[model samples]
Target: MLSVENLVVSVRRGPEIVRDVSFEIAPGEILGLVGESGSGKSMTSLALMGLLSPGIDITGGAVRLDGTDITHLQPHQRVARNCGKVAMIFQEPMTSLNPVLRIREQLEEAINVHDPRAGPERARELLDMVRIPDAGHQLNAYPHELSGGMRQRVMIAIALACRPQVLIADEPTTALDVTVQRQVLGLIRELCDSLHMGVLFITHDLGVVAQLADRVAVMYAGKLCERADVGPLFRAPLHPYTNGLLACLPDPESGNAAFETIPGAAPRPGAIPEGCPFSPRCNRAQETCRSGPVPEAHGPERQVAVCHFPVRQEAPA
Candidate 1:
């Protein structure tokens, strides 16, 4: 399993950007981290990989892959162990992959980093594993020579070169079209099942979450507001922020004429409110929500919401 406990990230001697966030992804399971822009979802992922920018740092918390503690490791140290334990798929393949390098060269480089004994055959095998057709031909092509979807598949292939125990995908499908998005999502699920690798998928798309995630964790500003199984979280979201996010989804059955929107942009780090960072934009906010720290409330089946007045629902027997 990939476990993160009380993860805290902040700027150098500055305010926190990710506060006490914790979650886990079991082997063969996908945990979707959903939030609006600047909600610290990406920051949390960066902390796990020990890739935080110069001014930013992981102030507290633990990140474990399978059984190894990687929380305090330096960048080079993490990179050394990353191949067999943890790997990340970044947002844009164009930027993540080397534009000048042939697909084969890049894949070979990743494998050689951890296993020098591996050869050219391994690179071609990876392309096939990701279902990229004409693997042999594709391997010889440069990243720019392939389509956007193809480039993404190459990125996934590289990430899986060492068959990591845990995978962190940060908006991997954001740039793909609907058809390609579905294909990539299915590929991720298939790989997760086949490899039994825990996956932490970070994205703002709830539609994708509903389709891909086994569980969902809702984040706001810098804090995790709610977490629950995907079905329950979607059917009966506990946090108001989650409700607002779900409300924004278009419902073909309801025949709703307009889409709902969460008012106000998410607060930037260092500007978060003392109490609930979302209190300023929440429709149900009371004076208490804005004056004091919000306590986490527990519900059935391990559901958790950091709200004084989460949505009401009957407990399952």
Candidate 2:
């Protein structure tokens, strides 16, 4: 239900944070956006939600929600035009929630924003929807009173308050423990199926992507390096960055002690190289890789990699 094409977000009179990034999230599908820190994943989401902070703005391209161009629209405009159409679950629940307000007040406000006639009963139902225990009593509790997992569930409840068509969950499980993290991931999967909402699940964890996402998009230096079905992308990664990331994952079969790592760090924003940002660290990097603009190559089975020499070359069509 969401289509982002050639999206670009840049600092005012400065360098770009996200460049030429494009992806699509269809109804009832979860698209996992995986990347390292400062890779512009969050910035891209903020741009989508019209929540980009001052001094940063979407400078080019378009974001269409169900065929509507909401790219340059103000936050309020987006909400007015597509009420409850797009919602976000931020990285941290503790900060996202209000310190003073009770859970009931927060949820009720969200409900009323898109739906004025909705009452406190709606708030209670929302709590139950997120599978929170003692939904009736928890509404009276402040955010501090709830545990981390409970607070995250409440955050999910608030995001679902509007029954959004598109949900942008930016590292929603980052702060929770593994057990709680699994629960939250399962909940997201269940909700996506039941609600038939498209989810843009942005995270740095490939494990989570494997568990939850149907399709995976790998981002590096603000550009999409590879995208394919989750299984195929993991099974046979075409881009060097994708291959490196998989290599870094601990392999239980090998019983190896030392963790494999990509040799170098990612380039800082505004310091990106002219061509192929990952070329410097790529073992297969050649002189041609750094000489000019890198081009995207299409591999078999609907895979696309942004590199001159993909790990596996495209077959004859």
Candidate 3:
């Protein structure tokens, strides 16, 4: 029930950092926002939350919750108006959580702010909801005392305190071990289904997207170059950047190199050219690709990159 229309974010004294990005997150749906570093994944999430840093601002477009536009709202105002309607689970829990406070103390803070039913029991319930064992005992532990996974779980519990309609999970599994990451991903999927929470999952991990997202939005150098369902996009990616990303995934069965990286890195904001930002690195790019606006290919539920040449119908799986 959340829609971001042509949302543009820019640094006040610099160029547009996040350009014309748009998407929707329906109830019970997880829309994965994927891109390499500097592709503006985190910036887009921050823009959605009205949490842009001092120099950056939403220069264009509208972010509406259900139907009302909240793009113009200040960070504090957005929190006040859409606290329960929209909530975010930040990328790093260690930085998000208070180091000095007890786990229960932190959780109770969230409950007291968004939920009136505050107490040790309510705090315990939150911990239980996130599948943290021995919830009561862990409540007394400090952030430093908990493992990385445990701390992330605590962050999720706090985000769920308001039962938010839209949950922005910005790489919740970033630093966890693989096993813990799997558990955390599964927990997020289960919570989505059980609570019918619309989630905007931001990560550069396509493997994680394949496992968690119903739909995908591929961003390149701040521009959304493709949009499609996970199945079609995975079975056959339509954009060069999407294909590049897919091809870079390690294939255990094929005995390929452990790491297959894309040739060039994503461009820093303002360093990108006027036309398609991906042209320099795109294999199919031509002289014409740099001369005009990026071409968009739109289908029922799909959109592809701007290219003067044809793209492969089926990406290497």
Candidate 4:
């Protein structure tokens, strides 16, 4: 449903924030973009949505939605073709939803933006579709009156108010408790299944990706490190950064203790390393890792890894 090719984005007077990142999502498929903070995960999403700040520019690459190039379109033009066709649920619910507006007003605004003829009744119906009980009464409730989970749900309701074809959820469950987080995630998965919506789920949590994505893309220092199916990526991560991220996830089968973390910090923009951006923190790094451009290798189903030495799965001892 969406294809991004060699997308290079940067801010004016600043280093690139998103390097040659690329990926594709088919209808009803969820593609998870996983990385640590400052890994350029969110920046890529914003770029795709054409919502980047004033200073940022798409230095290179194209974002095609259903084979239509949308890279150079004006903001309003993008909305006309892609608004209801592609919707996004931002990371923070508290700030995403308008504090001054009532839930009904917010949702109806979305509906009207996409279909001006939609009335109050249609807005209430959307609330019910998102499983909000007493949908009619809650329409008058302001964002501040709702709990974090409810607000998140309201955001989802608004995003789905237009019945979008693709849903870009950027850390949709970051603020809620574990139980509520699970509920929200479940709702997203259920909705995707029922609506046959394509999803680009951006998050730092590997566990969430494991449970939610069909394919996974790992990014580091603004570049894509690896891309593979969820099963193969989790069982055997090809890139050093992907392995490090998996190592950091707590393994219940090994007890509840924290897993080993990758050492060192992510490089800041304009400070990325000469060769491999992850070499400083990667245990498997070799001398050559610091001296040359990493080569891209393609595996089954176009799985790609940008590394000098990709990891291979080992047989059981």
* TM-score to native of every candidate shown: 0.95, 0.96, 0.93, 0.94
Error of 4 at 29 (Å): 0.6
- Candidate 3 residue-wise lDDT, 40-113, digit = tens: 98999888877788999999999988788888676458557653357788777778889999988888877877
Residue 47, candidate 2: alpha-carbon lDDT: 94
When summed lDDT is taken over every stretch of 10 residues in candidate 3, the lowest stretch is: 299-308
Best by TM-score: 2
lDDT of 2 by residue, 21-91 (tens): 99999999999999999999999999998899999999999999888888977656866776337789988
Q: What is the lDDT of residue 262 in candidate 3?
A: 71
Runs of candidate 4 with Cα error greater than 4 angstroms are 81-84, 255-258, 299-302
- Backbone clashes in model 3, listed as residue pairs: none
Candidate 2: Cα lDDT at 101: 96
Candidate 3 wrong stretches, greater than 4 Å? 82-84, 117-120, 258-260, 299-310, 314-317
Per-residue lDDT of candidate 4, residues 1-317 (tens digit): 88899999998988999999989998889999988899999989888877888899899999888888887665457667653367789888888888888888788888887778876699888777778888888899999988888889899998887677789999999878999999899999988888999999999888899999999999999999999999888777788788878878777898868668788899997899989999988888899999778898675565789988887668447
Q: Which residue pairs clash in candidate 1?
A: none
Q: In terms of TM-score, which candidate is stronger, 2 or 3?
A: 2
Residue-wise C-alpha lDDT for candidate 1, range 140-234, written one tens digit per residue: 99988998899999999988985678889999999888899899999999999998888999999999999999999999988899999998898
